[model samples]
Target chain A: MGRKRTRPDNIRLTEVAELAGVSPITASRFFRNPEALSIGKRVRVESAAKELGYVPNLAARALASQRTEVIGVLIPSFTNNVFSDLLRGIYDAFESSRYSIQLANTRYSILEEEKLLRLFLAQKPAGLIVTGIDQTPESRIIMQSVDCPIVQIMEIGPDPVDMIIGFSHADAAQAAITHLLAQGYRRIGFLGARMDPRVQRRLAGYQAAMKAASLFDSRLMVTTPLPTSVTLGGTLFADLLAKAPDTDAVFCANDDLALGVLFECQRRHIAIPKQMAIVGFNDLEFMASAVPTLTSVRTNRYEMGRNAATMVIETIEGRRPEQPIVDLGFTVIERQSSVREP
Target chain B: MGRKRTRPDNIRLTEVAELAGVSPITASRFFRNPEALSIGKRVRVESAAKELGYVPNLAARALASQRTEVIGVLIPSFTNNVFSDLLRGIYDAFESSRYSIQLANTRYSILEEEKLLRLFLAQKPAGLIVTGIDQTPESRIIMQSVDCPIVQIMEIGPDPVDMIIGFSHADAAQAAITHLLAQGYRRIGFLGARMDPRVQRRLAGYQAAMKAASLFDSRLMVTTPLPTSVTLGGTLFADLLAKAPDTDAVFCANDDLALGVLFECQRRHIAIPKQMAIVGFNDLEFMASAVPTLTSVRTNRYEMGRNAATMVIETIEGRRPEQPIVDLGFTVIERQSSVREP
Candidate 1:
């Protein structure tokens, strides 16, 4: 669809340059690379541009330069709090920079991600930050062929497209299980929702840890393909209790589920950490303030996002990161929810 | 910063056209206006493009047409669950459409919104969906100058730049208070954080309702300019108690604070509804599933987002909405948290 060309009070760079008593090139340089311009010229251009309400034509500039000052970020779910924290870090990193972010939601679909990737690449983004390491063969080929630096975030794995930043989800889950085991809780159960690639890995880690302790039982785990929510957490926990009535501890895939389990326990008059201990992943802000101060695995989500964006920006500006793959790692934060009274 | 123009295996549209036995114009038409092309020609062009691995250069198309198939969206916060639900609706609305969203976070600053508005206008987006009604005077003028359709979301007010869709926050808060009043609760207090314009309106509503009952006391309220969180909710609730020890009910600015207040009440061994009633805004999923099920003012956030995007796209496609200003409204859901025993 063609857009209406009705722009009132259109201001030109040449007009701003004339008003500021500077060359058009100087004014352009003030917009593009202001550090290269003299202080006097930069100040004059800025003031004149402000006075004229001159907005540079980014579309034309993008065509001329064959690239946009846009860093394309592909995230799985907008509703997930995890990505929101990551996005804050990404936005915070680019706040003062010239580049603006163009975000796309893949809805946790690899095919959708691939499609979005194609669309983003067509625009010739300055750089890209994709969600995870798992990608289709065609998508990987497309990414490898692109010249801009790319960062795969959320989990670190072998053979990254370019740079990678994230911790091991499996390791984080295993640590949470280890903490529960050390707290003298046995017959531990697993509760998960929307078993995405990362959640699946977490489940794998839980199974491994339980198996190592000779406590692994398929009946102790309950999962649903429905999108994760607090309500779903309670429902899944109830299902887990029905399937394994003697369950002493529960490990949730995320904090929302853990919070749900806590609420369900309170409703059922079950004393937390005495009858049932709870552990969750992604120690969200609410976890520390919950009634029992829920125990959770703390992943460096914000730092991962910030570092990934910085790496892409640095590579774009000619400074490559010394470490191409960074595993920020995770910590199992033990709170009152999982601590038993000795 | 200049980019490396090293796109490997660059496939030209001319080669696709030759392979498809069609003119380059037909190949180009397939990407832009496929509906206008004959089925045979469209099929041939699609296959040819697929075989050649041709990605249409969006920058070049944007320059040629002077407009992009981009619908710019600006939201205040990324971490807030309220906006995340809104974003999901917006993304789902644009999922199958040719237009992609270019999201910008203003971080609750009107000045930042103004800067982002200017940047978005410079690119000549096909349409725009901006959050809230409180835009800077210059920003308003800039939006008015642009030809693209703009929809202001999150709150309905007088004097929209183009179309508008949202409920009244003040009215919603007033309703929540009314529900509490009807439940036989008096001496209600207010808990707020992040005092944004919308949250301020909610506070105003709380004050108006309290004054109507002639039970309003300045000491019965506690608020902070700090960002709202569950932890902050608990801390503010504690402040409210210290300021007004006789407070029997509390209305939180958002669900996070409400949840925090619930957790704090649990920690303090205060009976919910019996000792202190709690009501929250933005009925998040966790509200209905909490131990005592929380009461909340449920605003049509997802519908607001979907309707706003649809309005923008409809206007861009040469069809104007019959009702330019839409107030979707809100519902005060009564649950165990606010219902006192008969």
Candidate 2:
């Protein structure tokens, strides 16, 4: 082959085919399905395409000129296991489809989510999967203007641009607290961090349950806006205990916090389930192996991700979504950490 | 203002301009720099472009037809802290740039990596950052053919495809083993899981250190192919303790495994640093918070990621790489988990 030429994107496909000594149809076939061509023709066509700076995918690009085959997904947190598990499920669902997810991390900030949304809107993706229902007014207006299918995940809202796939955080948190109450523990304290929309919803859930049981106490809640970590768990639990020594059980917003709470209890010689019954959310792998084996709310994050992706793909392929609002509810797993013996 | 029309791939840009009652130059200018035109002109041009299915970035496409403003990143694992830290660094480096990472999870399978590479190659990304150096032969050939800049990360290899940014896992492992020997642990053991290339290299490092000390014993090492987890650490440590009851110290391949070993020690009432000592790799966020703060090799994953991205960006912008092979190296941290009492 002669010296490699830059993309003569200036030339036509017929000219490119002539340069490669092939028919226009053959050159077109090479881009769509090179497997159909023999090795000799395939190599020649590729070399000619490279030399001519061939950009044959234009037809394909034009086919979806309004929107690319990208499935734009927005999550509030990147490192959080909750979102990562959803990503795993999303990947699994789109694994066989012609779609690929364009992931954006919003740092659990509505402003950041808004910024990311504006950027994604420019691309006009085939569909979008967003986290939570709370969006800036400007962001919601943009969402409403877009004609493509949109799926809001992690929570259900009455006014979705198109669709939603998630459960009630309030109900889940209420169930966790009720579980502790049913086990005969009152004066339960809560530890929370990174008070994002979901966490706020969970707190509301906790408050509602406590109030219904005539045990609501603002002094029992310890919270911070800082990102959650194993150490934060200990710090928050310590704060809760210092203020409410009468605290008999604690419900952690996340497993990381629970791990910290467990470690703090171990350090203070506070007996678990005997003196303090603790519970966590998300039911991550470590909860099962903790010293006392922590109890946690088990939500089907993978299923949510998978279902969301499937919904986007089906909608993009022109299949009407059977349901616009899907509530993949949560379940609380009874483990040793939160269970007490009479 | 007209009814929504599909991309008319067959029509020319001039017809689109006339239909929207705008000059062809104004239509072209709108796609090139919409900010240059007034809001009304911009809207008209955009509608014309939409109605005609105009792909106006043709000039921009020709300028970089072989690539887009995307940096394709392929990693063996996604949620792993080690890789996540690297991602944070990569993002930090590219934070100010026009580039965004198009991440693909290979899940530690070479075939999957090869498959992902083929798809990315078709997109003709601006650059690529890949994990490890052990790509399939077929994959390497394709990498060689692609003219875009490529950087290999996570391990410093003698023969890199183009450029490399990482440290020596074997050396780090040897250092850990040597640390235990200095602490007076004679019957030290090694526990590893998900023996990927890096894990195998770590095992090599351990063997090298033990052999040099005339303490090499295959019976002291326990391994499995299951993905690493805290619970896996406990199970593997149990197997090691069962087979070699005299085992006084252990070096874990990853933090998850180390956490498990620590938990197991706690469960068996084995006093850390008294009856047994432990060390882990990757010094994750939880290492310092563990019951007996775990000692570990702190690899500069974030820095490596940042450096790799910086290198790719500079090279793509036509700057010569100062050094094609960068070894950031690793550090061993001393903590209570591996600190023997006097």
Candidate 3:
């Protein structure tokens, strides 16, 4: 039956409720907060909504509830694989939920993040998931005053806007460097690109690890402000090799650099993990398939994303997580690119 | 000045009008239709709005004008690198404009796309950018009835919802296979993973090229409906090799498959281009960084995204493109992996 669809979403909640074999209030309650309803009521309501082609007027609902049926998600880059992976987890988590996602790409600019936050806050989203702890003080103030629950992802920070869920980039970096040292790479160098705040934290971890081994040398660390690419990885690694040929190993700030180092070494006929050990960050799917499978920091990016979404949604639904700040931790996957002992 | 930001957004259109040195009516008109106003008035109103950190209530605005200040984008997969590149282009194009984008990932499900389109339609978005033309017939009916302009990207078809901006995946695949044939590889095979509609089109192209060359062996074409990954490439290529031992080259459905094939070749100590050639789709940024430098179909994904966004915006602003069906076209970028001649 083709129902009379009006100017602005004419799907009646009563029709959906009748089809779902539930009360109209129950159907509406499902949209507002599915957690409040029983499982049978929730499934039946959802199925009916789908069959009847019912789409809740999020805009009208927002007006009445003073809560936009939207989630504000901020990330650094769209092209970056890391954020893409994190977003996959986020979308997966949010798909079954009623709230729509509103994404903003800050491009690693704190000012841009602040500006986007202003725009997002105006939407009065039900929940928010920000990327890191590096938002501007002005933006932080605005965020603090907001009524919605928020979760900062991808970095473990002592101070959070509301709650945070991520592994410690610094500690993860240290583990990567320590892995290299344990595998007999003493003269290890560090290569970084798009040296954002997170990269800086990773560098600090590398420094801490090297210093612990009494091999602290600033000369071996090469960095660039340019946006990162696989080719840039090669450029930075070549720069490191030229600057410090004695460097027996290198810990890359991220996978691109590590991959670049791998390619550059291959082009020049330099053996890996035997003569020059290399470690990358964020074990991208490609890293595993690369020749001499790359060793890298394996952060639970998907889990981090899922947890962040869960934290905000739960907080909004009156289910507070026991711990506001969750340090998911990281693991260093030992592969041929780093672990040579085997 | 910490203004009392509250329900209904404390920043009023009057404040924006005063800041821009214009009447409130003019400012409101600017938000409604910038094209109706002179350039000077439009700039002044926008700048004033930005300076005062004002965000127009898009929901309220949509009710009055029946045109939501947003674009509804339906994508297949967010995690896939190809879609990410396209989204990067889309985001860049929409960033400067007043319209915000609301994206929903359909996960390559036609039903999901239909559901999302229904939801998106209910929102009354100003325009819509759908990924492919493979919408369900029911969904197609709804789409045809929508008053807003629509632009479908990624795959160009004869019957677009309204407008289309993309290259033919089939034609692109044929070009790739033709390139390999020109390179004198007669025993070339095709490896496809996650055979979504686009990939299916690509496969048809492969079949077309191989049949014309009289080399179409059904045994040589290996495919999996499982989601694609770099390692999946290795697995599928190995399976292909097992079935067709004379396979001298392989045309992958996408870059991930190509990368996997390359890694498999390396693991097995097979020489690239010399012993076996390879071609990949979607010349992703990392393709060039691979050891032998993969040759792939270079599609203008970013341009497609940008063009789609531009078309939607221009339509909303009352400007129509000369053509509704745009074939942006594709190129076969010759690289080391496929170019044994040059």
Separate DockQ for every predicted complex: 0.73, 0.30, 0.61
Q: For candidate 3, lDDT tens digit of each residue in A239-306?
A: 98889989899899888888888988989889987889888999988788888899988988988888
Model 3, B193-255: lDDT tens per residue?
889999999999999999999999999999999999999999999999999989999999999
Better of 1 and 2 by DockQ: 1
Q: Write the per-residue lDDT of candidate 1 for residues A1-342, one digit (tens) a residue.
A: 765777535587888999999999889899889999999988999999999888887777786777789999999998999999999999999888878888889888999999999888887889999998889999999999999999999999989999999999999999999999998999999999999999999999999999999999999999999999999889899999999999999999999999999989988999898999999999999999998999999998899889999999999999999999999999999999999987
Cα error, residue A30 of model 2, in Å, equals: 12
Best by lDDT: 1
Q: Compared with the real two-chain complex, what DockQ does model 2 have?
A: 0.30
Q: How far out, in Å, is residue A28 in model 3?
A: 6.2
Docking class of 1: medium
Best by TM-score: 1
Q: What is the TM-score of each candidate against the true structure?
A: 0.92, 0.86, 0.91
lDDT of 2 by residue, B268-294 (tens): 999999889999999887888878788
TM-score of 1: 0.92
In candidate 2, how many Å is residue B186 off?
Answer: 1.5
Model 3 lDDT at residue A77:
96
Q: What order do you get sorting by lDDT, best first?
A: 1, 3, 2
* Best candidate (score: DockQ): 1
Q: iRMS values in order, in angstroms?
A: 1.4, 3.8, 1.6
